[model samples]
Structure formats: C-alpha cells, structure tokens
Target: MLQLSCLCGQVRIALKQRPDFVNECNCTLCSKSGAHWSYFHPSDVEIEGETSQYSRQDKDDPAASVHFCPDCGSTTHFTLTESAISRFGNVQSGVNMLLADESDLAGVELRYPDGRAWFGETDFGYVREPRIIGQKDTQP
Candidate 1:
C-alpha cells in the first residue's frame, strides 16, 4: 500500500495499488493548486480525517469538489460532484500525488496533460511529453 499525508498530517490517504501514471494539468485550478493528481476508483483509495471541500465558484456546474487539509491548507484529493457523477458514471477520484514522497514515486510516469486547451468536449492533448520519475536522462 502507498501512504500519503498532508503537511500537517491531519489528512491521510492510502492506496491499495500504486498509480501507473500521474497527471500534471495546466488548468487554472490545477495550476493554482500545484497538484499532481493520480486517478483511482474511490474503492481503491482510503482517505482519513476531516477535509474542507471547495467547488469552483466560477463555473455554474463545476465537475469536481476539491478537498484539502484545513490546518495546513494542503490539497489532499478531489471527488466528482453530483452533477458530474450523474453525467459521467463510474468517474474516478483524484488524489494529490504531490503529497507522496518523491522516493516513493520512483519509476512512475509523469504525464503533462494540456488542461488549458481542454474544454470538456474532447480528450486532452499533451502539453509536454511524459517522463519517468527519478530516472536519469540517458541521452543527456
């Protein structure tokens, strides 16, 4: 199992299996939060402790509600909103992989998705190529 905690240690998350890849998005919300997200089904993840939730006030129908540790203000995770769940069933929750130690994420692929260009209609294009965590560049 993989364990992650907030800076204040007020919030904790356990994942049954490590994620294959983590997403680094460039959307306004994600960029501001500085979150590297790993997606998983809610059943595959276990979250402990109370969290403060925030939904985007800028959108009329925000897709997800972000959760954070109130004390340290660290982003912990995000869950699909009711409207989003209704629209896209079986949606996965996102855990802030940034909370995990860098050593723990060795060999994991980091993908840069172009969220800035995504408008809720089509698949996301890559903002940049993916890279393996903790791996040295062989060509350099």
Candidate 2:
C-alpha cells in the first residue's frame, strides 16, 4: 500500500497497492496540471479530505473530472463521469509524484501517451514509448 497526500496535506489518499505503471499524458489539462496517472478501481483507493473539482468534456471521450486541493491548489486525482463509468467502468487516479515522500519508485514504469496528438485530431508526430522516469541511484 502507498500513502499519498497533497502539498498542504489537506487531502490524503491510500492506494491499495503500488502501481505497476504511471502515464504521463500530453493532454492540455494533464500538461498544465503535471499529473502522473495511476489507475484504480475507485474501490481500491481511500481518500480523506475536501477537494475542488473541475470537469472537462470532449466529443470523442467521456467527461473527466479532476479533483484538487482547495487550500494548496494541488491536483490530487481524477475520475470518470457517470456516463463514462457506465461505458468503461474504469477510473483513473492520478498522484502528484512531486508531493510524495521518498519511496521506492524504481520498479514503476513510466509511459508517455500522445494525448495531444490523438485527442487534438492531429497527425501522429509523437513517439509512443515507455520510458523509465524513476530509478534508484547507486552512487549514493
């Protein structure tokens, strides 16, 4: 299990298990918020605290709602809307890795998804690859 909290510690989240991978999407909202996504079943997460929500909708995809700390302005997590829930039945929970305490993230894989290209309806100009963004340093 992993414990995650916002910058001001007003919002806390308890993940049932370490995520196998995290996604770094290049979507407009994701780029601005700088979130690394880790998906959960909603039932696997325990959240405590109040958060402000911002919902975004697109024609092609289901509506997504982002939750942030009202006090610290930290992006905590996101969820699929009811319509999306009925369609996909999957929820994505993002954690601001910058706010997380020192933990072993060496095993987690980092993926870069070209949301901008795909969602923007532009030509495929980006590379689809899974890069290692976190690893242990042996020099210490």
lDDT of 2 by residue, 1-140 (tens): 78888988999988888777777778888888868777777888888999998886555554678889999999988878777778766655556554455455566776777777684466534446575545643332
Over 4 Å off, model 1: 137-140
Among these predicted structures, which one has the highest lDDT? 1
Question: What does candidate 1's lDDT look like per residue over 1-140, in tens digits?
Answer: 99999999999999999999999999999989879999999899999999999999999999899999999999999999999899998569999999999889999999989998999799999977788999974533
lDDT of 2 at 3: 85
RMSD of each: 1.7, 4.2
TM-score to true structure, per model: 0.94, 0.79
Q: Count the backbone clashes (under 3 Å) in each candidate.
A: 0, 0
